[model samples]
Target: MSGAETEPGVLVLAATPIGRVADAPPRLAEELADADVVAAEDTRRLKRLTGELGVEVTGRVVSYFEGNEQRRTPALLGSLLAGERVLLVTDAGMPSVSDPGYRLVAAAVEAGVPVTAVPGPSAVLTALAVSGLPVDRFCFEGFLPRKAGERARRLAELASERRTMVFFEAPHRTEAALEAMAQAWGGERPAAVCRELTKTHEEVRRGPLAELVAWAADGVRGEVTLVVQGADDVPAVSTDDSSLRAAVAEREDRGMTRKEAIAEVAVLAGVPKREVYDLVHKSGPGEATP
Candidate 1:
């Protein structure tokens, strides 16, 4: 309890190397050596990392992983409340993104402990930079659902998502995820699959979802991040009653009943079902509003 006094408790979330240790930021070593407690996703990995960095950690070290996050966060926060600097580190990348640091961060923030980040190597941005997709407006979708049906349903929900999307996935499931994407977002939509980013064997494959599905069938290895193009803007439709009638009629031509066709068209067009019905039933042909 006598490490220091009158200093605010700071919770530092440090980002470690995703692959090559050489990529570690110099401040990471300084923080590890000086921190009062080092909470790591894997204590063994932390030990190895400290050995590589040649930093002597004088403070206590504890494991904070998925299995024990709920139990460990409070203990770490307790240390913070005692005016100790608790540094959080993961096996790779930043501490929180798809990692174990988020819960602790949330707790620390709620407890009024100052939270900061030692930003360093990041697989999300690394993959997105090399993905050659639109990065200006993109969303990070950490990981897709593991089950086949759930995964497909999740992708379907994003069918009309306008921003570029990013995802992290297991090597073995890459093909299946890409196949589902192709079926949901059209086979020709552009996408990129980045593998082993920032490592020696880093690979970036870019093309349509269908091509990626076929390519991944041969097998992929290492960590994977996927970036996908957004939906192209559709041609503007007349707000008149005729356009709605035509939309419904087109759906009915494909064997759907009037009600079923309206529902399907509304989904496909990303509009309300009630709006489609009103447009077809209320407004006549060319006089509809735009």
Candidate 2:
């Protein structure tokens, strides 16, 4: 054989139901049954899903999640390089979208292994499709930072993003995330909060950010996905030092760092944040800023 190596095995990324088990696609069953090994974000959930789908998983199952993904990638790569068909699935949606499997996919690619996907249910696509927002052009932002300060900074950076944005948030933090969005993007921005998508209790609450925040005030539950309208082209606003300082101060009072505030103010005012930073610093620290 010319000493040429054989082609490596394939890595299959299978999408699981975001909520309703019925939404699981037909090809996923074949992949689960035929894969030489299966890496699941939650093995228990995998078992439950197989049972509900009336499918049997005959492959060796292993845990693969955010916590152990990096450490486990090498072993999975070994299996792939050894010509074993490995299938990856997450608790919900497709693997590697705010979930595990990215490492293994990357490793497999680097090793010249063929990688394929059995597209099925996805929380991101479902939310975006049903969001009634601008689907023509959109982006999935995954989850926002958990910490308040970090989350604020993240929102500020995206404040000027012209494409529609989607974010996943925990049930308990839905209210807070929406509140923060209202603060950063204005309350009147159109958005939809999709909860328990594809399930019996699935809900898609569509309205302005302010109204949604008030609705979520009492509490929100289940898998929460927020789809917010993108920023419209804003006419250049007055960039007087006093105005700039006040804008930065407003975000600061709300817990944003100076750098974060500058980035945000810069995007909003359509001016270079660096210029604002220099101007603000030139005014002296103690007199204008607190």
On lDDT, the candidate that comes out on top is 2
Write down the lDDT of every candidate, Cα atoms only.
Answer: 0.85, 0.88
TM-score of every candidate relative to the true structure: 0.81, 0.87
In candidate 1, what residue range of length 10 has the lowest lDDT sum?
Answer: 281-290
Q: 66-148 in candidate 1: lDDT tens per residue?
A: 99999988889999988899999999999989999889889999988999989999988988888888888988898999987
Model 2 alpha-carbon drift over 4 Å, by segment: 1-4, 237-257, 260-281, 285-290
Please write out the lDDT profile of model 2 over residues 47-164, one tens digit for every residue: 9999988888888999998999999999999998888999999999889989897888888888889999999898888899999999999999999999987888788777768899
Candidate 1 residue runs with Cα over 4 Å from true position? 1-8, 234-290
Which model scores highest in TM-score?
2
Instruction: Look at candidate 1 and give me any clashing residue pairs.
Output: 240-288
Candidate 1 accuracy as TM-score? 0.81
